[model samples]
Target: MKSYLAPKFIIERDTERCINCKVCVNQCSFDSHYYDADDDKVKSRIGKCVGCHRCVLFCPTQALTVRENPLDYRANYNWSPEVIEDITKQAESGGVVLTGMGNDKSQRIYWDHLLLNASQVTNPSIDPLREPMELTTYLGRKPDKIDIDKQDPQSIKLKTELAPQVKLDVPVMFSAMSYGAVSINVHKSLARAAVEMGTLWNTGEGGLHPDLYKYGNNTIVQVASGRFGVQPSYLNIARVVEIKIGQGAKPGIGGHLPGEKVTAEVSSTRMIPHGTDALSPAPQHDIYSIEDLSQLIHALKEATNYTKPISVKIAAVHNSAAIASGMVRAGADIIVLDGFRGATGAAPKIIRENVGIPIELALASVDTRLRQEGIRNQASLVISGGIRNSGDVIKAIALGADAVNIGTAALVALGCRVCQQCHTGKCAWGICTSDLFLSKRLNPDIGARRAANLLRGWSHEIKDMLGGMGINAIESLRGNRLHLRGIDLTDTELEVLGVRMAGN
Candidate 1:
């Protein structure tokens, strides 16, 4: 069958400046660039380009230009170019259209609709450079009230017993991206960067490699439906244990790591046979009800000797607020909400774009519900999915997120271009592939420095934003919707976000 699918990108190489150095020939993993021996020139197969820009960056002469292929299809509002292409792909392959990364649709980004308040006449803004600003965040269950005795007027005693907590210098942590789906070096970079930034990185259900045990203090090992590598030592070595109930990209479904990505190390770490695909079930087999979930939580606490916080991660669906309420009552010390925009190594394109609610709505509703129920202190809340910058982080904090996770942003820091071709396992940047040759392209030291630098920069920006609001500490911003104002938002949106419209 002659495919009707048009090339997604167009690549042009200038002959005047072309040196035919074969740099692009070796750089592009997609086989878009080629060396023509007969013509003694470098050429391109434009149809093969995924637009990752590997050749453009490595090109010394600046002779290459890659841009979106302007294939002029008849304009149809209801049927978009992407839609048509997707239909075409399915017709040819007769398989589910798979994509990598988050939803690229034109959904309303709540972060853009919201604006932060700045102090002026009534309140004076403090200069972060001159004043001591606090971004310290603690994630875990908090006591409803503390009973203290000021015995000597100098010392206090008789404090209520507190649950285990994971202290972070900043209210930002790395999101879970499993080992087999990505590479070992990616995990190494994330772990090292988490340690450097005084934050934590999650080992997303794929299990922890032996090389990462040293960074366990900054690790959050995950237990999912598959229970790939849930061993005693794995639980004991981490600062926190997270049960991944669902993810935002493809909620209500399981995860699949292609057999090709499961290398020997991944097999050893996950306790699976070599080259076998790892498929996590949609639900934990033993967890049929909230009671079952509570039991598992208690069992994990017992396994950890009551030392670490147990976090339950769920995708932000319509009833997220209600679900989160149950999780806290079930003894979850921390609850993680992954929004629709969360990234994944692979997922059905339809599910990634169609499923899950926005994190903003879910966060506000959950926080409000928990507060109304007087159980807000029972667990801390962390949100992920589509957190782009420090501004998003601060807004999320204002909306009641204890902290925010950055998955795609962190990958971008480590040389990812958001090409959305991660499912192919032919990543030229080496950030998303398990192939040894491509994996080596990403140096762990460099990747760690880049990711850590991103956190440092964002933390500074968060402090600056907090100072502008006359808030010296990030904790003060939690659930303070008064500091947030909606712009061009509907009345219902304003109500749902718990914020007044701009110019109110």
Candidate 2:
């Protein structure tokens, strides 16, 4: 909180050309610009500026410019200019390389290439305004078939149904991020938002904060290798339990929360020693194979009394279909595929960009394989990693996903510039930081509203897309590849996507 070790970049305004239109003031959320009471002139606080360039880009007059301090370190190319600079800054202070949200680089985010379609003039589009659009979706394992006829007419059924459904108001849910990695207030915000929106929020591998148990109905507690804060009581409070296999940002790596960020509250919640690093092992010891995964799943089930759904989240890779199929057979109620391009608080840049397959292909392949094996209904599939907009969500559903989990996009809605500094715990936007003062910049109420608005907007767009496709419900759009056609795809690609050539 004292000072940013790297020399700061400041934005200066040309007062001669500046009108008191308050455009820059309105544009900047960082409170960098303020009106001087005495002179009625706009003043800028250089220390507060994040150099996000929002004000500069939106300024009506070309009156603003940003410049870095002369003492700032010059860019180097040891491991790409960006990586070199990030490393240089972090090394200078000996602090963690903090970042917000997930990996963001031009690494073939598959959603861009795949396109969505609408019905032609010959086909009629449904009027969503006049008719109800079903956005409600259910998560958890689904039954292949129900048999009630075997029961005697007079006999009462004593045993309860095996699996219960966890319904979501929207198809999108918040991704896991632990209390220690973020803040309790941030967790509370997400919890309240999930409750209000009727979605779910993941507890990440950091374990559950006792204060957040009130949102248990909408929470998905995670069990990672280290099992930092996990207990039978903690496991019993969630509607869903996600087993963290690997994250997209650091596929083969584990997470380490330095002692500096693990405050007393975080320590207590995570049940780790205070002033010690919280280390989550790269992989669970019990899960060495598909059979091992089932054992762990059953262990959790036994601990939680089989009440909650268990989700296995893995980074989407080349063999995602086969892995997901194995997960289904491993008693997984839900399978979450985190694409390689997914974001993390802090991860090795090499892993973020170079690892994993795109969600589009992963989702399509998994869905196809599940259906082919006739186990598509055995467990639900949720896709994550780079879903940028509503079109991406719709396309993902069409490619065969029960729902999607959004992390980077949600933070952006809450005012993140994707600066990739979340690991440092000093987010300019305040959404990803633990500093109470800086964190206050994000009013959870307003943040939740903005997040809700984004989801609502996307939902409307999804409905519009579905309407144009002559689909009355979103379920109808799920896995309906007949509504899609492949363009510029090779024979193998076309075959994999289950689409015909453009001309045909």
Candidate 3:
């Protein structure tokens, strides 16, 4: 007795081009293809396909085609097929519906609404190839003002010294993806890529793999509510230690690594019992207030002997600006703001779709609040959630982000199709599954190299954009909202973004 829900994808094979090599049957991990021994031909269970197209690539004969299944039900704009199907799924399973990747709905993409300005006769644009365009960014606290020693006027020795900063050659870095959520090779690729690109990769909640200790210089180890794999060594090994207060995908909720996904290796890394649910409590019980946050922030600094910067990460909620201010005053040298459209390995579908605001608004608001409070120099701001390309990175910097973290895009480059089946523990791509067979699909060297290439290409694009703006350094773009102009946004949107209309 199979469920009557319509299949989302249709797997078609051209009979004339079929060589009967059975490669399509063997390649698909979803069991969509099978050999019919009685008929001596290959057949497909179209309803089972997630349309990842992995088999299409392996089919040497080019006989396979995957497409979206035609909708049979009457079209209604409000209660659409996806909504109806989700209801059926929840009714049948009696479980929370799950999805992977990011939000798939049409929402206000502020990046599209904001346009970048270019230099003209008054300020001629510089050629990136011929001029010196700087893309390197340092993430950490900065001094508000410099005081020089009068005795050594020629040397101009600083009275106040600078704090520890993680210098990144590129403003884009790979975001957090936990060990139980993504394969070890994925982590290795991120670590290797960060090292090669001169950036840092965040170890999301999950503990750092022992093999990756060598790349600790480029690692940003996290201490979330679960405190998974958090130790003195964890604090000391990384260039920065981040505290994960909440995530954009499921704000006010905790992380859920299903018992089914808790493999032996994952258990060892998370220090939890095998085949048991690893649920992080919604709030760090110790951190009941902002003062409590200060305790933990200083604790990490103390453990690291004040050698590394401490970052506090929070979801961009309605009061994100106020919360960011508290975090900066609480001894945080860096602040990470994750918006609603952020990707998650697993989260309740309702919470994923309906919670939090966009990163664009959150970043603009938080940066303004901090600057107004005169704490802008107290901490560096890093933002994430639905950052699609180099343009998005450039726009984020213009809106006041020191750096941007990219998770879904990096995974896409590593062959992820975003089929939204991550909760089932059977990711079609090797990026987000613990299954040994599936994990083998991603080669670490290739994955790392691909990640590096993405950063390199984006870095070049950033330089190009900067040169067009007549700005020589990346810091000049930070919080420089004057360089951006709004298109069709409302009065409030423009005011929140601190930008003018395109014409004015």
Q: 414-453, model 3: which lDDT tens digit per residue?
A: 8887787777777767778888788888899999999999
TM-score of each: 0.98, 0.84, 0.97
Model 1 residue 341 CA deviation (Å) reads 0.9
For model 2, residues 206-292, the per-residue Cα lDDT tens digits are 888787888899999999987878888788888998899988777877887877667777788888778788888888877889999
Worst 10 residues of 2 by lDDT: 1-10
**Ranked candidates, highest lDDT first:** 1, 3, 2
Candidate 2's C-alpha runs over 4 A off are 1-10, 13-80, 83-100, 150-162, 501-503
Task: Order the numbered candidates by TM-score, best leading.
Answer: 1, 3, 2
Residue 2's lDDT within candidate 3 is: 66
TM-score: the better of candidates 1 and 2: 1
User: Best candidate, lDDT-wise?
Assistant: 1
Q: Mind giving the per-residue lDDT tens digits that candidate 1 earns over 404-471? A: 99999999999999999999888999888888888998999999999999999998899899999999
Estimate the overall C-alpha local distance difference test score of candidate 2: 0.80
Error of 2 at 246 (Å): 0.9
Judge candidate 3 at residue 445 and give its lDDT: 98
User: Could you tell me how far off, in angstroms, the CA of residue 294 lies in candidate 1 after the best superposition?
Assistant: 0.7
Span of ten consecutive residues with least summed lDDT in model 1 = 150-159
